[model samples]
Target chain A: MCQLLGMNANTPTDVMFSFTGLATRADEHKDGFGIGFFEDRGVRLFVDHHSARQSPVAQLVKTYPIRSDNVIAHIRKATQGRVALENTHPFQRELWGRYWVFAHNGNLVDFHPRLHAAFRPVGDTDSERAFCWLMQELAKAHAGVPAIAELTRTLAELMPTLHRHGTFNMLLSNGQALWAHASTHLHWVVRQHPFGAVALRDEDLSVDFAHHTTPKDRVAVIATEPLTQHEAWTAFTCGELKVFVDGQPLG
Target chain B: MCQLLGMNANTPTDVMFSFTGLATRADEHKDGFGIGFFEDRGVRLFVDHHSARQSPVAQLVKTYPIRSDNVIAHIRKATQGRVALENTHPFQRELWGRYWVFAHNGNLVDFHPRLHAAFRPVGDTDSERAFCWLMQELAKAHAGVPAIAELTRTLAELMPTLHRHGTFNMLLSNGQALWAHASTHLHWVVRQHPFGAVALRDEDLSVDFAHHTTPKDRVAVIATEPLTQHEAWTAFTCGELKVFVDGQPLG
Candidate 1:
């Protein structure tokens, strides 16, 4: 299976540590990798059909300290689409005068929803098709960008239809909040005050949050699996959909 | 005035030389800089609110050697928008299953058009407003993506309306072809067989095309002013709209 990683924070934060953990897992899933960083209303999306383990783009992501409030990343194993540049995720589109980014971990068998609205998939992946359908339905659900709670409620209503097809674990962000849904394996952790050093499960690298972050900083990270061994990670239920805002989960 | 640069080629070609020439001019137009490169249907967009002469992102563009068939780049003087990341161009949006990139060099005065369609300006800039209006009208002009020739003809009809507002020099690309329209200053040059060495107009750097490009390779480059010192550059007439496909301008 492909792997997924996401972050939501009250302030802009760099994801070099977590991304390094994710990139180490690229050994198994070497089709492609992509990461999107949301800086206010703008997004810097770096996608390569090359493996994150070796791609220079991935190297830039690891070394550059691009602070963003929301981030979504994926390492692809090519379950549904060809290993082409156009098929690389995370996919991005504009809606309601803002950019929306999406990345999927699991596979869908034959899911193809009606894409009647303005959004369309440039790629042939089912993930891109699902993202387009979500944008279309979101556009129809509101005249303009509605409240985050309303969007979460609408998305809650739409998730089951997509979930019925197959595994639908995914992460989405519109720079305001991050929404993550899981039908299979997914885990998360929240780091706050009194931060301690943590070690990566797949690599020898570790970082002490106490040195790098402020006491008021709060960060929530979600991944297909626990990225670090020492952190207290929480696993999502089989059919859970959660919305994270400002580093905290909003029920 | 801001500066514009564009490239359309018969094959995927690295843009380091032309972009370096453009970056040297960023010494004055240091409000921001952006570049978009199309590889097949996928695009790699690098934008920074910092000057291209010093921004780390711009440094990556210069060193990475990412190749593409179509490209659009801008060095902004911030004539209409704040010097923020969100306001940086070339602006991108998806329409009819294809990503469209746009960058404008000149200004428009009191040129707000009705934006009743799906495309909207995320940034508060006259250039973005104009681009959104163009996308909205183009969506109305055709139900789906028109042929390149048809789209160029439609743009030819649409340019006069925007040109009358003020200076509307711009470059647009949809990965298939590049369209350049000028209300004031714009120039283009085509490089083909028997390529020779050329020097940058703004910098002392020079590169011999014969060592880098194949005999069959053809490249069309568009800029606000000529980028090379020795090349024969053709200046666009006022209100002229030109379409380039496979490195050649279509009559």
Candidate 2:
């Protein structure tokens, strides 16, 4: 299985600490890794077939304080495709004059959907195919970019078709909001005012949120597993879909 | 105006020397910069609103030596759009399961085409708009990825439409081949067997190609101006479009 991490914040924030925690876990998921950051409508995507622990691109991601409002990252274990750059995670495409980024964590058995639209996967991975299918469906559902709530509803209606094939834990963003669907394993945490110190579950390093954040800043982070210890990480139930905006999940 | 640099090589080649020369010229074009590298069907794109001279991303690009077969890079002066990430050049989109990268050197005056297809510009730049329109037209012209010759013909037929608007010097690549079009300022050179030492035109740096490349290696480089001092760079006439494959331009 692969691991996924997503962040949506009310303000631009860096993911150096969270990404370091993820890279430490890259020992098992060593096929490849990718991350996408949305700075408004512009996106910067870094993908490498090398393991995140060794890739210079990943090293830059860890050290560079790239402040973004919406970010999606994935570390791949390669269940469905060969270990290649095209099969790396955090696939991105442009739609409706906006860029959409997606990353998946699980495999689907025989989950081939018709891709009759302009959206097509450049990679052979099942994950890329799934992302292209979703983009095609989303493009068909709306003439242009609709409201985020409408998009969430459309995605909610479309999730079951893919979830039935197998595990479907995934994260998607369009620079506006992040949509997380949990078929098996997913957890999310929101950091707001009165931030406290937290330690990585796997790494010995610790960081105090109070030192890096302002009182008005809010950040929500979603991952396949809780990245840090002693935090209010909420596990998602099976077959649940959630949309996060402004660092909080919508009801 | 921006500066454009493109490379198409028979084998994977690092652009550190060429890119360093380009970055040295980024002093005047200080709005932003971007570079896209094609690694087979996969692509690695790095863009920043920050100037290439100062951006950490550019620093990594210079030192990391990410080898690629086809490369498109731009240093922007921001003629039409604001100095933001979205407005940076070398925009990318996918068509027919192949990723296409584009970067423009000159401005297009009042050029807006009807974008009625899957490809759309996330950035509000005339360069991006022209690229999106070209993608849409290419998608419409073919059912899938056609042969290189067929694509070149289609593009040749479509270039005048964009050229009539204004300056349309551009470089485009879809991993299979690179297409460079010039309206005013563009130059190209092919390097093959018995390569010799070359010095940068703007920088004090020099590199010996004989030390790095095999005799079988062939490389075609395109730039707004000649980057090297002694290379036999052929200037492109206005409205000339050339397609390069396997490191050589087609007749």
Candidate 3:
């Protein structure tokens, strides 16, 4: 399966995304990869037609402590789009004066929709098409940027339409909140105050989060699979849509 | 004046834009900087709120030879918006299923225009506001992507309106053609067959075009000033809009 990772924090947090050196996981999703960080209203999107483990772009991400309140990363296996820079994810589009980042895991069979709006896919990908459709629908549903809860409600209604086509596990963010809808495999873990040393995988690099986090700081990390073995990661059921704000999932 | 750099070529060409090294020039435009490269239909934009001389992103541009057919680079001195990442130049938007990149060199005063469409500025910069207005107008002018001549005509009408506010020297491209509009200083130079070893300032690195270009390859470079001392750069007069296609300027 393609890999997806998302993080939303109360404070702008520096993520050691590649600190554990996920070389084994990279091989499974090696068509290309991308990562996006929302630093306030500005978005820094880094994408490459190379494996995250091998891309120079990824090297910079690993070395640089890009602080952001929201982050989304994806590794693609290229089920639909061709293996090129244009097809790489997480794809980005701007709507309602805010940048949206999205990444998907599963493939859609024949999920084409009428794109009669401002948003359109630059690349030929089912995922990009799906994203454009979602943005178009959202723009239709609201005149101005809506609150997170209202957006979640709108998305919950629209997601089922796409889910019927194929496996639709995905993650989305608009810098305000992180939205994840899973048709199959997706997991999340929330880290709160009194954080301890957190490590991903077996014998991976560990961070003494307690030394860095404030009592009020909370973080929610969503991925296709549990990144850290010790953390109590919660798995999403079929056809689940959840929104994360200030590092905590909201109804 | 804030510096703007753009390149359009028959084939993908490399640009050496370490404007930070232009300290005499940098002093005037040290607020922030950005650069965008169009690779096929895909666009890669790197922006930072740091001075070009110090930004890690600019350093990457200097170190890496990213080849593209169309490129736009800008160094901002922040006239309207606060010195923040969102306010960085070389702003991007999607229109007619193609990604459009824009960068402006001059400031506009009281340039408020009704942005009654999907395009909106994520930043508070007047430059971004101008860009959003352009996108909204362009979306309105054409239901689909218009021809270069048609777009040039639409822009000619729009340029005068914005020029009424203040300076409006700008560059825009949609991977098909490069357009330059000027209310003041904007220069362009075309390099064709019998390529020469082009050098900028004394300390600047030179490129042996003979080695990298074919006899058919033609490139047009537009900048706030003539980048190379030897080339005969043509300056645009007030309220003039010109489009460059296949590395040649079109009437």
Ranking by lDDT: 2, 1, 3
CAPRI grade, predicted model 1: medium
The DockQ of each candidate is: 0.72, 0.87, 0.68
Q: For residues A1-251, could you state the per-residue lDDT of candidate 2 as single tens digits?
A: 79999999999999999999999999988899999999988899999999999999999999999999999999999998898888888999988999999999888999889898888889898888999999889888999999989999999999999999889999999999999999989999999999999999999999999999999999999999999999989999999999999999998
Report lDDT (Cα) of residue A227, candidate 3. Answer: 81
lDDT of 3 by residue, B1-251 (tens): 78888899989887864243332366557798888889888888888877877777777777677788898888888778888878888888889889999999788998888888999889898899999999999889999998889998998888888898999999999989999999888988899999888776635566678897789999998888787767789998888898998899986
Q: In terms of lDDT, which candidate is stronger, 1 or 3?
A: 1
Q: Top model by TM-score, which number?
A: 2
- Candidate 2, DockQ score (0 to 1): 0.87
User: Global lDDT for candidate 1?
Assistant: 0.92
TM-score of chain A of 1: 0.99
Candidate 1 interface CA RMSD, Å: 1.1
Which has the better DockQ: candidate 1, or candidate 2? 2
User: TM-score-based ranking, best first?
Assistant: 2, 1, 3
**Candidates 1 and 2, the one with greater lDDT:** 2
- The TM-score of predicted model 3 comes to 0.95
Number of clashes in model 3?
A: 0
C-alpha lDDT (0 to 100) for residue A139 of candidate 2:
87
Interface RMSD of each: 1.1, 0.8, 1.0
TM-score of chain B of each: 0.99, 0.99, 0.95
